[model samples]
Target chain A: MLDKALSGSSRYWTWVIALMAIIGIGFVFWVQQMIEGLTITGLSRDVTWGLYIAQLTFFVGVAASAVMVVLPYYLHDYKEFGKLTILGEFLAIPAVIMCMAFVFVDMGQPIRIVNVFLHPSPTSPMFWDTVALFGYLVLNVVIAYVTFGAEKKGIAPPKWIKPIIILSIPWAVSIHTVTAFLYSGLPGRGFWLTAIMAPRFLASAFAGGPAILILLVLLVRKLTKFDPGLKPIFKLAEIVTYAMLVNVFFVLMEIFTVFYSQIPGHMDHFTFLYVGLDGNTTLVPWMWTSTILAAVALFLLLVPKLRRNEKVLPVACGSVIVSIWIDKGLGLMTGGFVPTPTHHVVSYVPTLPEIMITLMVYGVGALILTVLYKIAITEREIIEQVK
Target chain B: MAKSTRRGFLKLAGVAAVGMGAKPVYDAFARRSAPEQPTPPAEALTAKRWAMVVDTRKCLREHGCTDCITTCHLVHNVPDFGNPKDEVKWVWKEQFEHGFPEQHNEFMSDDLRHKDVLLLCNHCDNPPCVRVCPTQATWKREADGIVMMDMHRCIGCRYCMAACPYGSRSFNWRDPRTHIAKIDEGFPTRTRGVVEKCNFCAERLVRGEIPACVEACKAKALAFGDLEDPESEVRDLLSRHFNIRRKPGLGTQPEVYYIV
Candidate 1:
């Protein structure tokens, strides 16, 4: 099946080569970061975590979103998702890889990552997050391999894989829950210290992940011989709509609790993120943009006619991804850090090297996605030709 | 032939895994078998639970005094990055409001409100930093309540930094070797990508000497002693003075106390 990826048109090769070039440049900067330590990034004493951690948080949601498709298809016997389930799993492969990569890049001592396993502390949420992510990655890889292989052979997947697929459903939820636990369970950081964190994470993940999948599937339709019918795409759009609505509702709940109660500890972070705390207003514009985009996305997705419109559907999905990306990936991390534990407001902006390294991680994800997607499409094309 | 070869390979792999696994098991057994160093040497300052009491009245008596911070940094070989962003602090001076954000008093005495209070690691009984450290790189000492950091073992994830409600821990964001004015020959300087903070001078206490900051303070603002010993100075200060712990509401049970 990998051989299918090796033979592609000039256009496919151009995209693949472009991703490789970006990856190469990013790798060079990563080596520089290792040499300079975390000082090369925007991370400081007050704002300890920045871009890498935010990206890791966002991608964890994206990786866990694979269950959205997997659960519906495997458990409910949703025939519409039968052709699309593999796409979801394959999308997860790169997303998880990107998640893991973001973690690796974020570490101050990347070489010492083995310490987490060698001297594991079960009490730590990070330890559990690492375990959950690794397990989720393996589950997806095995399921995708076995099921896709069976499809290629024109036979059913082996009986042994059923239990693994069932196990993956709960396992997917665990990964994002553990990731949320990393932030939410901390003694300080009022922005993250909420019971709603894990639920909010899942809601945004379900919204953002499938939204990304819709865009990818649309791209696949245009580029490949395989046309994953409108039924699954529209179904995914509906999921994105509801998830986005819930995500917005969760944010509103948080806002109401924070503003109405007027707890300075909790309100300070929200104020710092949405408005400016003290004189620091760097994140104000970005936060408002994300808020506006979320509103725009919700409006487009909620209207049935607009959602069904081919052009509008992609726009809504794109808005959802970008909005949630900024909300979770940028705002969430900074909000937790700023108005530091001591009430000092410090702003963080990712340096050139840091942003480059981030782009590089995305490039690696795109490259893996392109190859895996190429193989899936090629197999579908072969099946279509046979029919 | 294939089946026999496959079985042989599995057997080889099993043997290799056992060989790799034996050292840690042996090390664990060796540790359990060895005599425990349960008691400190007679000359050493032993503590059942270590604690510190900072007299802010005495601490900020002199204008712009940084004796404690200066002595601590010099003794610990803590680098002066000259910039706040990459600054590594062991002990530092912060205003009363900033030091204890939870104790927000708008109409406090002008002198108390304006004065700089000394802040360092509280070494909490229920230390969130220790609990959150994935590698067990940081832990609360069994004999003493001191939260210890094994810089060598830390992967520098900074989970401890976020978890520390007091903003005590500092990550070596850049190579610290470049910035230190003079190396403290006795102390081990840390590499970049590791977290470091005041260890309550555990090294000095083991050598029968008090913490450098406590020793250097002319005003006698900082008192360190065994909290378990009722006769100790820290106990005496706590009994006499109206003392408060930072963020007492969080239930971290900070060993460090402050007298306003």
Candidate 2:
């Protein structure tokens, strides 16, 4: 399988090289952050978490999205998705890796990462997040490897893989739930302290995560001799549209509750995000862009003509990814800190090093993803495309 | 990297999430069964529970005295970073509205509303920072209830800072040693990345001394003593004045009392 990764076209090799170059640059910037401390980033006492934690939260959603394909195929016996499940599973591998990597770069003491395992406190939500995420990563790796190995050797996946597949269903739910618990469990952060936070995370994950998988499968179909079929792609698009509608509905519910209740603590974060607190609307433009993009994405996905058209479907998927990316990636983690513990409205803007470190992690994810998909595609050649 | 039979690997994974999760899950349950927190060292147990009461009337806010702030910061090796964004303050004055947003009112008496009240770690009986720490890097001592930080153990997660409702915790944003104008020889300077806060002068308390802030108070506003002891100065002061704890409704049981 790895040998297959090595045997790529010049174009593929060029892409791999570009990602490698970025990984190197990212390493240097990470080292600089280490030497200089977290002060190199725009993070302050008020906005403690900045870009890295936001990326961690976003990728957790991506990792959980793999369950969408796994659920329909394994539980419901959706045969069109039979060939597509592995594609989704493989996508999760790099996403989880990047999730942990983002945490590594964000840490003030990356050296003490061993302390998490050295003294694991089950009482802590973060400890459970580690367990859930690491567990899911290993589950995906084993499931994808064993199943793909079986297919390569021209045999059925062993009977034991069935129950493990079932276990993955709940395990996938836990990953994002635990991530949400990181914020939701905190006492004073009104922005995140809501019962609906876990559901909101899962809803957005289902929407944006599968949309990304659809894009990847489509790319693989165009680039390789394999075609996972149009039927599965359309079905995935349908799941995304429904989940995205739920995600937007959930956000609206949150907005209605906050604005209606008129609780100052609850309203403080939204005001800071959307309108800026005390005339310091630092995030107002970014928040508005995300809101508008989400609406445009919902419009593109909801319209039957635009959704059904293969040309326009990819654009809708991109919008889903971008819109959710901004919502979760830009505002979600940092926004909670506004109206800080002391009720101050200081803002955070990720410095260049922080942005570079973020881009570097993405590059690392891309490289891992390229290799994994290449291995899977080589085995999956000559698949029949359903009408 | 070694190949195993698919069945063998699947067996291991089921064991991994549930089997490995067994001890910690059970330990969590066991810890829940016990009402008390992990016991502190024997020395802490010998001392009566320490607490403080600050009388705003005697704090000399009108004179703009920073004696308590300067004494504490200098002794604890707190840096003088000119950058407010990266400031590392253990104790400082914050306005009433910012410090007590839950008690916000549009109009109030000028003295109580306008003055910058001294703020520090409340050292709550139910410390949220202690509960949320993953590495047990921070914990409330069972004896005196001083929330202590094991700086070596902290991974710079800053989750404690988020959990603390009072904004009591501060991270060393830079190599804090670099910003210290003159590093105090006695106190160990904190390495960058770990969280730090007022340990209620736990070291000084151990040496049969009061907190630096209490000692440096020219107005005799800061009173430190065992809250458990009826004869203690803080207890006597709290009995006389209708003092309040910040965000008392949160039920953190903040030991620091303020007499407005």
Tell me, by lDDT, which candidate is best.
1
Per-residue lDDT of candidate 1, residues B1-260 (tens digit) = 11222333344445577656645644544544456668757888888999999998888546688888899999899999899899899889887889888777999887887678888999999999998999888999899888999887889999999999999999999999999999999999999999999999999999999999999898999999999999999999999999999888888999999998
Which residue runs does candidate 2 get wrong by more than 4 Å?
A382-387, B1-48
- lDDT tens string, model 2, B6-42? 3223434435776466555445545434456765455
TM-score of the second chain of model 1 compared to its true counterpart:
0.88
Q: Give the C-alpha miss distance for residue A196 in model 1, angstroms.
A: 0.4
TM-score of each: 0.96, 0.92
Q: Give the interface RMSD of each candidate.
A: 7.7, 7.0
Leading candidate by TM-score: 1
The 10 consecutive residues of candidate 2 chain A with the worst lDDT sum are A378-387
Clashes of each: 0, 0
Model 1 chain A worst lDDT run, 10 consecutive residues: A112-121
TM-score of chain A of 1: 0.99
Residue clash pairs of candidate 1: none
